[model samples]
Target: MGILLRHIFILIIIGCSLSVTVIKTGWSEDLLFFTEQYPPYNFTGPNGKVSGISTEIVQEIMKRTGFAYRLKLTPWKRAYELTLSQKNTCLFTTGRTTERENLFKWITPLTENPIVLFARPTSTIKIMQLSDLSEYRIGGYLGDAAVDYLVTRNIPVETVRDDKLNVRKLQGGRIDLWVTGEMAGQALADKTGHDIKKIFTLTAIAGGIACNLHLSNLITTRLQQELNTLYQEGFIDRIYQKYNPDLPVPVYKTK
Candidate 1:
């Protein structure tokens, strides 16, 4: 009986050790990050590696939290779908909205991304408010929050898979207005060699990191705390300065 009890105690010790190991390593194993080719926020470099403002912020969060992850630069639609359906998955640079508020656990307000409507230089379109866009066909990218916002407002919009196509469509007069972020629109315009001018500001929204519902609250909480620390310590400010020296650092509100 003594030997049996000793064996049972040893087994208990082993089990506890295994549990601790699993707890330590399981968070990293379960987390997968998804992003897209939205420049200045999340995009691929010439070497095919993910790097951008949002990516840098997320990397700092991960580094501080000690969470290991694999980030993939995927199509926006696929990345959004995977984050919606998969467990322990996260997507960055996601716009936080009322419709998407309850869908996932959000760690938010990473950076300011004001949505704007742009048009060709010689176009004679006047848009003073959101209601003025009803008569025009706006071009946007698929799986973008701006597209969803327009649809919700019953605005007419044509969506394509690539944002660069929207710039071309606007240039060719295929679409009256191109809806995109201020910074993003400039980047796409520069890339496509099109000089598009902003017509109206639809809304000013900050982007965030959205995690799957199945992700542990503990992990999310730690990440949120670390992000808050980043903001408080001006680490995020330095990152923004590295990307856009002329612009002010974005202030993210903690949830």
Candidate 2:
């Protein structure tokens, strides 16, 4: 199920009544958004609609800021390409990296994601340093920052289009290691109904939300400030608890 780039110019004027509609005071049909299934963060619903913690946060910003936007679930590469080529388009739940820092005029920050490395529990491999696992095969998703971060260093790693496949493959003894977020990996682990603890290891790493460079500086500044505000107000932490009640997440700190 691939969502290709189609410029749907349909106006989705939301949060407005007839009285406000007549005045036409607030409007900015200038935003396009994209996402992919990176579960616990973003995922497709049973009804095939987009909904997750990240989506919820983005929706909140939309409601508060009145940024006219469209969300699409597509292959990461496609979404990234669209965001790069099309002005006013933004991709979310992207890792903040040195390579991509200058590319997108980021919306400061939107949410928090902790980058991590996971492994089957029974595996004898214990990693204290990234170089320690260089001799073994590592599995990561295509277009995922981990793959790019590792592959660029000439490390031996495999790329899978779907991260779930990596977990399944790891559980089946097809791979020696898999890298992903602890939260999402655990969610998939549970969804698969497998005792993953007997099956994975997790390493704490960096992840967050970013937008395309096309966004205005004002939006970027406001976005960052709002993230701080949301955290201070306990909104993000509440969202995390709603999605994950028990386990701890690096990004969701206690107030």
TM-score of each: 0.89, 0.77
Model 1, 1-255: lDDT tens per residue? 999999999999999999888777658574789999888888888787899888998998998888878898889999999999998899999998888889889887687788888999998999887888878889999978888888899886899999999999999999999988889888989988999999888887768899999887888888889889988888888888888875435666655
Clashing pairs in 1: none
RMSD (CA, Å), candidate 1 to true, equals 3.0
Residue 120: error of model 1 in Å?
0.3
The worst-scoring run of ten residues by lDDT in candidate 1 lies at 246-255
lDDT of 2 by residue, 1-255 (tens): 123222232222343455466444323455677888878778998888998887888878777776667888888888888888876677877776777878776643444445566767766776777678777777888877766767767776788777778888888888877776666777787788755542233333345555666556666666666666777787877887888776454454432
Candidate 1 lDDT for residue 211: 92
RMSD (Å) per prediction: 3.0, 11.5
lDDT on C-alpha atoms for all candidate structures? 0.86, 0.69
